[model samples]
Target: MSHAEIEIERRDRVTHGDYIAKLDTSDSTAKLSWTDRQGVRHAEHTFVPPEARGKGVAEALVKALVADARQEGFKIAPDCSYVERYFDRHKDLSDLRA
Candidate 1:
């Protein structure tokens, strides 16, 4: 898909008492949430549905969240496997890590 056609957005939804990064596609959806407490932000879990796998959807959501964190002046502590790998692969965003 072209960059313009890709729709990446974050939903500020609370699930089980945690902030979640929900990726909403045309038909499917995925989610990632941070283990944040007491002004400390920690990347906790990323949940991609079986149907949404292998579509680059998760990457987009994570990238958007990274940007959001940087823009908001917050640091990220990625505990999610997918998020950890994303940081490992994208060294450019390492500057935003805590």
Candidate 2:
């Protein structure tokens, strides 16, 4: 349950995308999902399994998403409740908000 053991990956489709966080030593995973429209990334949902709860899996997923947003030059619409709170906590990334 350490952040160092978590590896996050992005999966993008035609109109939607997801960030998947996997633990290198286990089968556990966490996910954050979003849709794209007119260049805005609509963050819609985040799912962290019960076993992975309180272990920073969701945080890793969100961080990966935000990193991609910054590197890809895209804005994010925080439709997911978790993402909304994340953004609220980190005002430094407000420039990436949609």
Per-residue lDDT tens digits for candidate 1, residues 1-98, read 33344465555544222333333453545666665555446778877777656767667667777777778777777778888889889898787776
Please give the TM-score that candidate 1 achieves against the real structure. 0.72
Top-scoring candidate (TM-score): 2
Residues 52-72, candidate 2: write the lDDT tens digits. Answer: 688888888888889888898
Reference-based lDDT, each prediction:
0.65, 0.88
lDDT at 34 for candidate 2?
95
Each prediction's total of clashing residue pairs, residues at least 3 apart in sequence or on different chains, is 0, 0
lDDT of 2: 0.88
Per-residue lDDT value at 50 in model 1: 76
Predicted structure 1: lDDT: 0.65
- Check candidate 2 and list the clashing pairs: none
Stretches of model 2 off by over 4 angstroms after superposition? 24-28
